[model samples]
Target: MLSIKNLTKIYGGKNKAVDDISLDIEQGEFIAFIGTSGSGKTTALRMINRMIEPTSGSIEIDGKDVMQMNPVELRRSIGYVIQQIGLLPHLTIKENIVLVPKLLKWSEERKDKKARELINLVDLPESYLDRYPNELSGGQQQRIGVIRALAAEQDIILMDEPFGALDPITRDTLQDLVKVLQKKLGKTFIFVTHDMDEAIKLADRIAILSNGQLIQFDTPDEILRNPANQFVRDFIGENRLIQDRPNMRTVEDAMIKPISVTADKSLSEVISIMRERRVDTIFVTRNDGTLLGYLDIEDINEGYRKGKDLVDIMHRDLFKIQIHDKLQDSVRTILKRNLRNIPVVDENNILLGLITRSNLVDIVYDSIWGETPAGVDEA
Candidate 1:
């Protein structure tokens, strides 16, 4: 557990990055710090680890004041990760990943075992152990950085926009990875980011900061449904407009009607349909009403270059929530599948309607801010 009492960080005469903030972070809690630029979220985090010495107040980690501990020892016990990743170029992937453990004087056998475990934990191949940092992609390097922080087996991890540099797909993957890792390790996490979506998706509890002050701290649903003020509302963005939408509504409520696409369709064919219809995804079905897979532009391009079949490229491991399934169930499918759109299918695999991520968010917003549209009511 960690506790902050009257935490304040001031720069010279006028810059106060954190202003008299107090918070208690329980063990195994995934807490996110969110705010716009100059909000002092990062400052508050840094002060906890003595990365940035606080101007006043005190921070206690597991009951002892962090300021009273040696900075080097304190840092070793707390994992730190930043947006830049900061992997050592001279080191091999395994070496880079094992840096912290090595610093802690872990045995060679222990180090090797830990390295392999972390590599697999982050979904990297064991073959990457011998590879240099430069030989890996940005996402791979970021994974290595995460493994390195985790190498020492620290109880608390301080991450500042750890996934900010990766692409959207990689970002989502890593977010899922972090969620899994947190459950496995049961360690406390203090994460800072400007991205509200990421905060909401990953956080067990979110702490909103504005102009160096703590504005609100609560669960994602609470924050989304009942924003503390206009500042928090605007900060959450237009997505908040639909926080109250019915979760009971099905894809039938928002899906585009008329089944589309063929099993033998080529990437080019799917692309043409997407462009012509101004749609990003289409459902694939067989002649006898069997649902095959869903095709999106990205799926087409990835499969096209390999000369793969549409069915082969299609994600067959599709998760479907019925028309009457709870809205939370649909949202879960979207998050778990990392999908932007999901097909609402009946028991017979009948293609009903589609529910895009935007539509789901809109439903939530409409439930809160406006009347449910006539179409949804009918569906």
Candidate 2:
């Protein structure tokens, strides 16, 4: 458990960057600190590892005072990720990830094994471990930075706007990845961000700060449903208050049956089904209704002569959404990625349905224009 009691930071003489803030974080909880610029979110976070000393109060990790511990040892015991990534350009990806382990004097064999495991955790190829950090893209390098923080298996991870620099798609992907890693590894995370959507999406609880004071700290749903005051409501923005909008709340509300076929189907049969449905793409499912992949008209045009069945030419690099995801969370992805439609699956990856661009338009239209008037009829 991590406890902060009356944590306060005053710069120079009288500037209170973090004023009388207090919160308790449970083991393995994902917490986010968010506020406007100069609101002291970053200051409060930096205070956790003694990057910035507090002017008053205390921070205890598992009942031990962090301030009393050696600063170097305290920092090395905590995982930290930042916006700049801070990967050394001269080191290989493997070497970078295992730096902490090496400092801790872990054996070479154990370090190598740990490096490979972390690389796989981020869904990167093991071959990239030998490559230099400069060889990876921005997003890939960020992934390395994330795993490097975890390389030493620290109990608590502090991330300061780690995904803020990436494009929307990459940021979204990394958010999902980090959340999954946090849950799977059972690591405590204290993330600082300015994005409410990101905070709600990733945090078990959010700490909204303002003017060097803690405004509200609670679960995302609780904060959205019952904002503490006008400041919080304004901070959250009106558009995200989807509770009042009843027409389309979740992806499941708008999903329509996808045009799909079993993976055993022949090329001619799959093509005929697409022609009948007037869709350029057709999903391929297994006998158990698991999403195998999809085949598009272009794939057929290029590989029909050599392919044996739908699985032969199907593309598995598919983007998808869960059935229970909020519509608001998915809207930006659909529009920004310019996708015609995205598959909706259940927890088990079973093909539930699909949400198309048309469905999204109708949802947005209804949210703005509302349902048809009583006794009204269309021409």
Candidate 3:
């Protein structure tokens, strides 16, 4: 267990960066420190490993005072990850991972075994051990940075906006990976970020700070349902959490059965289905319901006039979303691709259902109002 009591940090002789903050984090809990800039979130995190000295108070890990321990040994015992990653460009990926182990005088054989194990934890291949950091992509490098922190086998991990520099897609992927790893390894993590959504998504409890004071610290569900004060309510809008939670579902969870036809169907048959279904586009699938592509009415008519079949007119370029993909990501793809609807496919490319604009609107309406969208009668 980590116990923080009246921890205070003052800089420039008088400015209290962290003013007498206190928190108790259970072992194996994922805690997030989130707030506006200058709210001392990072200061509070840095204080854990003695990266930033506090003016007063105490931090104890497993009932032992942190101040009494040697700073170097204390730091090495705790895993730390930062936004910049700070991986040495000259070092091989293996060298970077085993640096802490080498300092601890671990045998080369054990180090090699540990390196490969940690590498596999992040889904990286053993082949990456021989490559330089520059050879990896941004996401791969960030993954390396994460596993490197865990490479030391520390009980506690401190992350200071580690995914802040990544793009939305890469960041979300890393966030999911980290969450899975945290649960699997049962490591205690104190993550500091300015994003409340990230906090709510990843944290079991959030410590919201403001003006160097701890504003409110609570679980995501509690914080969303009951904001402590006006400051918190404004900082994290009441409806923000509601809007985000329902939208995080998978495509399979949110999709609806869409109008579809097999690719072998005639153009006249495709046009008839489109007219009957009141849709301008028809999903083209194989006889086995595996998505082949789509057909627009205009294309179908052109094909029919030219005596062409559905297979000749169907557009295979339609953007398809995986059933396992996050609904939020599906929404983004829809907007980015300017798509009217997206076909949801399984791992085997078999069509399951689709996410339409109406489906997204219904989800939003239900999330905000806590009810189904009103029809013309209700409206």
lDDT per residue for candidate 2 within 1-379, as digits (tens), equals 9999999998889999999999999999999999999999999999999999999999999999999999988988999999999998999999999998988999999999999999999999999999998899999999999999999999999999999999898998899899999999999999999998899889999999999999999998788888999999999988777533632378888889999899888889888889999999889999899998888899997778775566777899889999898777687677778988699999999999999899887777576556667443352
For model 3, how does the per-residue alpha-carbon lDDT over 209-238 read when each residue is reduced to its tens digit?
998899889998778777899998888875
Lowest lDDT 10-mer window, candidate 1?
A: 239-248
lDDT of each: 0.82, 0.90, 0.87
Top candidate when judged by lDDT against the true structure: 2
List candidate 1 stretches off by more than 4 Å. Answer: 243-379
Task: Point out the worst 10-residue segment of candidate 3 by lDDT.
Answer: 368-377
Ranking by TM-score: 2, 3, 1
Best by TM-score: 2
The best-first sequence of candidates by lDDT reads: 2, 3, 1
lDDT of 2: 0.90
Compute each candidate's TM-score over C-alphas.
Answer: 0.75, 0.90, 0.77
lDDT of 1 by residue, 1-379 (tens): 7999999988997788899899999999999999998999989988877989999999998899998999988999888888999999998999998888888898999999999999999888999999999999998888888778888999999999999999887887788789879989999988999988788768999999999999999988788778899999999876433532453454566555644687877778777887888886778888765677777678888888888888888777765556665565457548656777677778888777677777766666566746656776556
